[model samples]
Target: MEHHRSISDVLIIGSGIAGCVSALTMAEEGVHCTVITAGERLSYGNSELAQGGIVFHAENDEPEILEKDIMTAGWNHNYAKAVRQLCALGPDVLQELFIDKLHIPFNQRKPGDWFLTREGGHSLPRILYCHDHTGRNIMEALSKAVSEHPNITVLTKRTAIDLLTTHHHSSHMDFKYSLANSCVGAYVLNEHTAEVETLLSRYTVLATGGIGQVYLHTTNTPGSIGSGIAMAHRAGARLLNCEYVQFHPTALYAGKRGGQRFLVSEAVRGEGAVLVDSCGDAFMKRYDDRADLAPRDIVTRAIMDVMLKTGDDCVYLDAARNIKKDIVKRFPTISERCRNISVDITSEPIPVVPAAHYFCGGVLADLNGRTTLERLYAVGECSCTGVHGANRLASTSLLEGLVWGVTSGRDIARRISKTEPMSEKLRDSIRDWVNAGDEHNEDPALINQDWATIRNTMWNYVGISRSAGRLHRAFSDMRTLAKNLQDFYKNTPISKPLVDLFHGCQTAYVITLSAMRNRQSKGCHFRAD
Candidate 1:
């Protein structure tokens, strides 16, 4: 086993929105924090892939309208209070960024107001944006702010394989409540050095984003391996509905997007882009009255239904006819991608497909972002805080990250201030999860094959549209996949790709299980009877 070290006030996994925000917030309280990231850069997460802006109900916008829109998108089974909290606090946190934090730069909108872009679902314009790459801009702002803070340390190219636990550390201390005596630290692998090390903290936050890359195609970054949620599940956290995965209605058709034709944001549709058939015919009107502006669940299903009938590999999102052709300046990155990839907005339609985008279910948590496990707080996509329900409305992601990141940080600050640092025994317990230098099976091909099976199972059965048969098949496939991986993982040496692939495979199993258990057509989880 690798040697472990127990230190820090808080240890954060996944240095995206939640991680950055939480680190900065806690540092303000004089608490020293360490952030272990899975990539070379801070934004090397699903957060940077989001092209759309965030949703916020400002003074001019009615909160009830936002609530209704989100509830409808989530299919009404959403956590009402939590969703309401999101709606209530969203605008305030946004206001804090623009007004107090002084981050936003001439936000593109009417003078004295923030730019409100429309997306797939909302009846009114409630999205607060900073051009097309709102997520990147937001992450950059938080990352800059956090990196400058002395109390917070950012460890890049460090992937956290599993969470460190007090119970797992010592024999006598039965860590029944992980939060109370929980999360001593985490097991981190330095990608550069190719060595495993232990990181300990009073509080551990899993800000890891979506599991889109579990499929063959996704807008998510390849690093989005469901690390946090999977690690939390293994640590005895009961996961909620993991099946409700949202397939973005407008991902550029590709086997996998490593920064190529990643996505044409839904805001393009909101600006009057239309969905056209292969015959150059507009078809969305037949699907919904809102047509090009319909909610994501409706539009995605319509796209699938149309494709099924036509036997086509893809559908076209026609941006040629609208004044939105002039609006291409708003999305410079997308425009360049379109130009290089044989698409001209003024002349041709963009080929599109519904790709797995976000996972709405995770370790269930309350408003304060505290999970079932004590001392283990979750925020952002890693925690199923009941905000998204079955489907997440466009732009609510950054909102949750900011809100819960701060809230959870406040809880962490209180914990660290109240208690003494962990004992020496807890530090020793963390090193056991890592089998350092104990070389085992070295076949990369075998590990890759296991990963392929997992991805194919998720894409085929737990995909855009699912049914009882498909869900059952997916469950069975994932069960087999999980069992196979258990052996492969025990035997394989610890490599970054293998570790990421391993976590993703386990997450796929939970998602498939969640889909099979929730036998209803709701939001992104459509069950074709």
Candidate 2:
């Protein structure tokens, strides 16, 4: 098979907030980076779909208050150090990189003053936003800056197949895992060309986003099938907390079959929008003291309880009755999305249901974003820094990405300056990818059928609530599916859907196994039995 080769200081496997922020940071440090993305566009991940905002410490907000809110939201399972770092560095990172440098027009109260918005589990309005589409605006600014950077290269529609560790090099001792030795780079598949490329880099950062697509319903992008997590796992990187999947309590209940659904921002609740039953009765107070303002896990469970008791498919988010301000002006994206679905947010209650939204657990990385593997780092939703612990607080996802992305970029820049580049001989030793079969013998229908099975199995058994029986069953089923997918992956030629399916199966296996081991009902992993 024909192939391509490239060398860089760093190879980033995503192009969302983490990838863009890190690329911009490295470019400023005069480091060369090549960003490979599965999506053709820059803001294709969950970052752009973020309708709420990014969390930050405002002038009146104290570290202790921020820490308390985060800990409470995470059910006290948060890593104190990581949470402290996020709270401390988040404001500075946003101010310096986003506001001062990139000039993202975040909604401001006045000139040079940030317009802070409140979200669930926050003691105060410490979340900064750009009107409603905070992520979109932030992404636009970062994408422009990254595109103009001469030292950074953005390769769209390139899917990462696996990490290139000592196992891939003939001269070096073959190690089973990435943690056993240093990571040189990765095997990248060019989607347009149908060719594999050996991308060798001094450092590799896995900024690929979440694993939300594992479930039947999610608020994540279609490409968010845990490809990075799967690749890192195949490289033997330590994945922690895969079981703690955060279900956003208010994804617009479009249908069970939709790949991605509109997220009714938690800010809607923060603005006094309340969850109601079909009978139009406010129901949050019966679940938690915080009511509509409780942490996401609590709200999701509460909604689930209501659904179970009422035998309803979904609950309603009534914003018109509570929100004093014009709903359309506040949430233009949401209003338009609702209008598209023939629901008027200004007058009627929008139907919503809990769906898999974020992965709190991922490849274990330190505050510096260094993974268990040497010369390899992870950031954003793909990396579990333990900041979110068992559950993520609303609006903190974007903050985590910014803080960790910059930290990882700086760490890589410092390390790469000290370490020598890969030798020509070592780089050449990484061989081309060879396909075992020439025929496209695999049935797409079978693949899709198995994919749907994986989703339904996860949604029913390993969803917001789990038991020993359900988890064990999920684990067994996923293991069998994984084996079959692995067999197919070994034989089939490289395709985006096939690659996504292969990674999704691997990811589902990891999460199911993790969920089965952790018995306690903490945060999102609630056990009914």
Best by TM-score: 2
lDDT of 2 at 441: 70
Cα shift from native, residue 120, model 2 (Å): 0.9
Which ten residues in a row are the worst by lDDT in model 1?
253-262
Q: How many residue pairs clash in each candidate?
A: 5, 0
Q: In model 2, which runs have C-alpha deviations exceeding 4 angstroms?
A: 168-180
How well is each residue in 1-529 modelled by candidate 2, as lDDT tens digits? 7778889989999999998888888888999999888888777788998989988766778988998999988988989999999988888888898888888888877888777878888999988887789999999988888888999898988999889887655353334333457788988889888888889888999999998898888999988999989999988789999999999999998655556788999988888898999999999999889899999999999999999999999999999998998889989988998899899998999999999999999999998999998888999999999999899988989999999989998988888889888877667666666666666877879878988988999999999989999988898899889887777778777777788889999999999989999989899889888
Candidate number with greatest lDDT: 2
Residue-level lDDT tens digits of model 1 in 1-529 = 4454548878888788877887888899999998878888798888876777878655567878888888988888799999888888878876786446856653555666776777877878777777677787777777788778999888899888887666656454444344454666778888877777777777788888778778876778888778888898988766786878888888887433322238788988887888887988889999888888877778889998888999988899887788534666777777777777778877788888887777888888788787777678888887898888888888888788888888888888887888977776655444455464355666779766876777777888888888898888888888877887777678667888878877998888888888888877888888887
TM-score of each: 0.94, 0.97
lDDT, residue 437, model 1: 39
In model 2, what is the error at residue 391, expressed in angstroms?
0.7
